[model samples]
Target: MKLTVLGCSGGIGGARSRTTSFLVDDDILLDCGTGVGDLELDALRAVDHVFVTHAHLDHIASIPLLIDSVGESRRFPLTVYGSPETLRILRSHIFNWLIWPDFTAIPNRHRPFLRLQPVKVGECVRLGERAITALPAHHTVPALGYCLDSGAGKLVYTGDTTYCKPLIAALNQTRNLRHLIVETAFPDEQHGLALASRHLSPSLLGAMLDELEVSPQVYISHLKPGVGERIMAQIACYAGRLRPRALVHGEILEF
Candidate 1:
């Protein structure tokens, strides 16, 4: 299995900044953010399943556009998986026909272009030899992290979470964990705002990392646009022992 970082920034600014989204191989999208807009129509058509992390606009901004652009070209409905609460938020806000057309009921209910599936924590959705498992995440809204296991190695993505001990405990028990893509959306100076928004700062991230048992290659993502360098530098000072690297856009990780 391979995962491509389409966007890792908390917000967008220059060419390098595109919100949070990751493409898993050719068919699965971990989160359909603004980065999905960068893909060609052919690439967009290849996406079959989208596993959403939360209802935040930054993480799901591209979902409606993706379905609108390729709904007719695809042979099957584009399936989107999220926690029940997250799916409810999507139905109430996004696919309610006011914000965007209700693709889940478009054309006909029986033959709709989109499908939404609710996945609970600890449930693993398997496709062929690969498995995508929902993990716990603590965020302002109903949220979830995901574990992508391909039998060979496992990659865990903590999408938009704060300091969650339950997540850390789950990670400790995860075997063959090769990569952990976590988020630090603010610098150490913004600890108050970080806590208020349920995001992680450098110091908070350090505290979370101190409890990890598995030593997977940790990658820090979702840095707020302007202060990304400062956040990374602070991460170096606070969590340097783990040596978490900043996740670069367009980078690919294979397992």
Candidate 2:
């Protein structure tokens, strides 16, 4: 199985794109963002399931476009999975036939193109051969991270969280987690703002790592473009046993 980094930036700026990632071939997407536009039509068409992290606009804004882009060619329904709150935000705020036409009800009311599935925290949902469980995250809104057990080992994504206890505990308990894609959105100087907005700076990210019982290939995502270099520099100071590296758009990893 392969995981692709479509975009992993805190905020947009030069050389940075919004947050979106996917586990392709299996046709499961992690998040949808502007970077999704970079995917080819064939890839967009192959998406059958999307596991959203939160209701944040950046994490979900590209969903509608993605559905619409493949609406005509898709033969199967596209399932969007998220927490109840996240699904509600997408329904009432995004696909309410105002911001965008409700593709969930588009084409036909009975057999719509998209289906929204509410996945609660700690619940494990099976997708083909993979078992994915939603974990809680500390964000401005109700959010979740995910732990994907792909038979080989587990993979965890700390979707846009700050110093969260539940997520930290989950990570510590994850067995054989080969990859850890955590978000470090700002430099150490902006620690106050990062904490206030439920984002991680290098210092906080280090603390989160200290709580983990196992070490994995820690790849940092969702950086704030220009400050990515500085954030990583500071992270190097205290990231013991955690192989922290910045993720670039289009990077692919296989497990």
Candidate 3:
């Protein structure tokens, strides 16, 4: 299976888009962002399931647009998976009539285009030939990281999180972790703000990596716009004994 970096920036700007990533062939979307519009209609249509980490706007704002774009041609209900609190925020706040039209009840409510599924922590959910297990993370709201086990190799995607014990522990359980896609949203100079917002800075991310016993190829993403250079340099400085690289849009990895 191959994973595509649809969008990986922390915020939007020139050459940088919000957070969205896709596991191709599997039809599993890690997150949906404004950048999702870049995908062709046929590509968007192929998406069967979307697993959200939390209810943050950057991560889920494009769900409404995506479903709306698919419109009448959508034959099956799009499955939206997330934690209970995350689902609640999406349903009661984002997908509710206030922020956006609730597609889950659109098209006569009986057979709507969207289906929300709440996935609890540690539970493994089937996604075609693979199984995704939800792992815990440190974020402002209820958040989760996912480990996709395809039997061939495991791929872990840490949605948006700070350095946490559970995250390190989860990575330790996997034997053949092919790729580790984590986030470092800011430079070490912004550690205070990063910690306050429950995001990782370069220094924090490096310390987190020291806990890992496995040697998965690390791909760092979610750098704030215009600061990628500074953040990347700091991350590289402390990347000793670990293989790490900054993630770019269109970067594809197969396992």
Candidate 4:
């Protein structure tokens, strides 16, 4: 399977910088961020499932707009998968009519425009030959990383996280892990702020990498737009033997 990077910045500033979002093949979305807005109408309609990492606006900015744009044209409801806490937050704040219309109940409940599925850590959801599993994450909000196994090879996306041992353990156990897309949100100078915000800095990321057993093609993503250069330079010094390159806006990874 091929995974396309739609947007991978932690925050947006210019035309090329967009918040986190990734498209797996053509049918699945890892997170529907601002980058999703760049897709054509038919490309938007092609998405059948969205697996959300958390309830953060930067990660889910396009869900409401996406559903409104193509929900009526689709033959089936758009499925959005998330953790229980994340879903509760969306229902309470986002889809509660005041923020955005609850498409889960729109056009009659029996055949609504949207569907919600709650997935727990360690749970695997299969779609045809693809297996998408929710991995552990430690962030400010309820969050999850994912491991996508395409039968032959695997790719792991560690959606916004701090230093968490469960994540490292899970990664070490994974087989055929071809690509690992991870986040290093801040530079080493902002280590204190990064810890407070439950994000990873260069030092923290290196510490995690030290425990890894699998040597995948690591690609660093979700850096704060302005200070990406400094963070990456620090990563070069601290990130141990695996020299992970920065993940670009439109980069694609096939596994």
Candidate 5:
């Protein structure tokens, strides 16, 4: 499986600063953030499934637009997978016609442009030979991370979480874990804010890593736009033993 980082910044400022989104192979998306907008119309139409991590705007900002842009060209409805609570939030707030048209009911209910599927933690949804499993996440909103198993190896993405023991435990149990893409949203100076927001800072991330049994290649993501360097420097000072590197936009991981 080949996973490309569409965007990894916590917030947007310039062209390179795009919110979280990952393109999995060709037909799957990890999140539909602003980074998704960068895809061409044909590429947008090619997306058959999206596994959302949460309902935060940064993570789902382009979902509505994506459906609106490609619903007509697609032969089958686009499927979105998330936690029940996250799906509920999307139904209640996003696809409620007030904010955006409910594509699931558009044209006809039987064969609509979109579909929402709820997945629970530990549930693995298999598409072809690839298996994507929803993992536990502790964020401000109803959230989930994911484990992408290519059958050959596994790549884990800890989507916007703080210090979560269950997530660590789950990762520890994963066989052939090759890459770990975790979040460190703020610098240690903003540790209090990070805690309140249920996001990890450098110190917290270091602490979390100390409990890990598996040593996958660590890639840090979701760094706030301006303070990315400072946060990464702090990560170097605190979590340098793990040798975590910043996840960059357009970077691809093949396993």
Candidate 6:
């Protein structure tokens, strides 16, 4: 199994700064952020499932567009998985006729272009040989991290969160955890804003890392565009023994 980093920036700016999204192999997407817009039409149409982390605009921006772009050509409905609350938010806000045409109801209700699947924490959704398990995440809205088990090893993605005890405990229990992609959205100076927004600063991330029992190859993600370098420097200083590198777009990890 291969996982590709489509985008990892906290916010959009230039070509390099696209919000959180990841392409799992060719058919599955971890999030539907702006980075997905870069894909060709054929590539977009190939996406069969999207496992959402939250209802945040940055994380789900391209979902509606993705459905719209390829709905006519595809034979099967595009399935989007998220927490029940997150699915509710998408239905109430995004897929509503006012915001965007409800693809679930378009053409005909029985044969729709989109489908929503609600997944709970600790429950694993198996697709062929791969398994994606939703994990706990603390954020402004209903959110979740994910554990991708490729049968060979596990890759954990802490999708937009603050310091979460449950998430830490879950990670400790994961056997053969090879990679950890976590978010550090702010620099040390914006620690207060990070806390208020339920995002992690370098200090908070360091604290969380201290509690982690597994020694995975940590890759820092979702860094704000402007202060990313500074935040990474701070992370380097505070991360103790575990050296974490910054995640870049277009990077691929194979298991």
Full-model lDDT, candidate 3: 0.86
Better of 3 and 5 by lDDT: 5
TM-score of structure candidate 6: 0.98
Colliding pairs, model 3: none
- Residue 162 error, candidate 5, Å: 0.5
Taking the tens digit of each residue's C-alpha lDDT, what string does model 1 give over 127-206?
Answer: 89999999999999989999999999999999999999889999999999999999999888889999999999999999
Where does model 4 exceed 4 Å of error?
none
TM-score of each: 0.99, 0.95, 0.96, 0.99, 0.98, 0.98
lDDT of 1 at 210: 89
Candidate 1 local lDDT, residue 9: 89
Cα error, candidate 5, residue 97 (Å): 0.9
Q: Find the number of clashing residue pairs for candidate 2.
A: 0
Instruction: Write down the lDDT of every candidate, Cα atoms only.
Output: 0.94, 0.85, 0.86, 0.94, 0.94, 0.94
Q: Kindly state the number of residue pairs that clash in model 6.
A: 0
Task: Give one digit per residue, the lDDT tens place, for model 6 in 25-113.
Answer: 99999998999998999999999999999999999999999999999999989999999999999999988999999999977889899
Q: Over all chains combined, what TM-score does candidate 4 have? A: 0.99
lDDT for each residue of candidate 4 in 1-255, tens digit (9 for 90 to 100): 999999999998999898999999999999989999999999999999999999999999999999999999999999999999999999899999999999999897999999999999999999999999999999999999999999999999999999999999999999999999999999988999999998999999999998998989999989998899999998888637677889999998999
**Per-residue lDDT of 140-187 in model 5, one digit per residue for the tens?**
998999999999999999998999999989988998999999999989
Residue 63 error, candidate 3, Å:
0.4
What residue pairs are clashing in model 4?
none
Better structure of 1 and 2 per lDDT:
1
Candidate 6 positional error at 113, Å: 0.4
